[model samples]
Target: MSSPRPVWTGLVTVVLAVAPALAACSPEAAPPARADAPVIVPGAPGQSGSGPARSPAEAGPVAADVRFAEAMIPHHRQALEMAGLAAARTGDPLVTAVADRVADGQRPEIAVMESWLRSLGRTPPPAHDHGTGDHGMSGYGMASEEDLTRLRTARGRAFDTLFLTLMIRHHEGAVGMAAQELRRGRDRAMRAMAQDVVSGQQIEIARMRGIQRRLASP
Candidate 1:
């Protein structure tokens, strides 16, 4: 058994014996590739630049809040129209002044409420045409067709009387709606707005009533 000779050489024997030991020690030593995860490269931190989007409902009121806003917007629009006519038609300096103030006050409120409705993903209801013709909500008083005709046809003091009477009725309707909100509403801003409506319109109603009495006498 002299050296079963060099059939299987020393080098061949050494490779066969060492290969298993090396594999056992290494055990798949390669690291996971970088593409497999987000790289947290070292640098200054920064924001994502994108912001969370607001939902339609998140932008404004919803549910009963939406219904309230819808109803109130048209109502406020009507009030503004009435106020404008009072300003244009009335001759009594005090009545005209009040009308101007009322109109100015209501116009902005109309815009705010309408914006709120849009934000809430709601449509404002169509206003009823009270047939004042082009006069808008100024025609919304308890006055009949004949009364409105008198209002349109009259001048000076006559205009003042009709305007005050109509405005009183309009303010009453607004007060009624505001009261409804006080009773049934939950939104903080809207309810606060309703309270403002009540306070402001009530004062106007009183002023109109006084104007009516003053205009009626003699």
Candidate 2:
């Protein structure tokens, strides 16, 4: 007669035989998280704006989510344009540093939003579009063409002051937009992105204000 199977081997066989059924009955057997899911970064110490990350597979985008992405894309583009002007225009180390930070943070966010739109079978707006029509600049705090021109032309300390003032206003608008998304958007990924916008830009706004105060002093 063949030797009896070892106890450990028998237990392993039993577990293997039952594993599929166990998984089928388990709540934790949900599909793996999507790679493109938006993750909300925690806010700095003492701040209250952090949010939970969720998989894109969890929910479909609502109209609010679409609108938020469409509008924010161009809004962030304009920000990049402004940030691009910093290296050549400003002598202030603080201004240059903040501009670099803005560009660094928002550039990938724009890509994510655009990719999200494509994933929904929607076309992203033109890169040059500054969120016109239904999502106009009224509440978005976007600088006007004239404002951009002025920013383009100014140099030295003048550029630093104007850049900070405009960026503070711009950040305030983004925060407002993010807040709206949080209230009305249904997609978990979009909501996560919105929360990040709220947390990040608010911090930048405070920093910009501090820089403004420093600029104002003798």
lDDT of 1: 0.54
Question: Which stretches of candidate 2 lie above 4 Å from their native place?
Answer: 1-59, 130-134
The number of clashing residue pairs in each candidate reads: 0, 0
Deviating ranges (above 4 Å) for candidate 1: 1-62, 126-150
Give TM-scores for every candidate, taking all chains together and pairing residue i with residue i: 0.60, 0.72
Q: Per-residue lDDT tens digits of candidate 2, residues 24-53?
A: 322232222432334343445688645564
Worst 10 residues of 1 by lDDT: 30-39
Q: TM-score of model 1 relative to the true fold?
A: 0.60
* Positional deviation of residue 173's Cα in model 1 after best superposition, in angstroms: 0.9
Query: Over all chains combined, what TM-score does candidate 2 have?
Result: 0.72
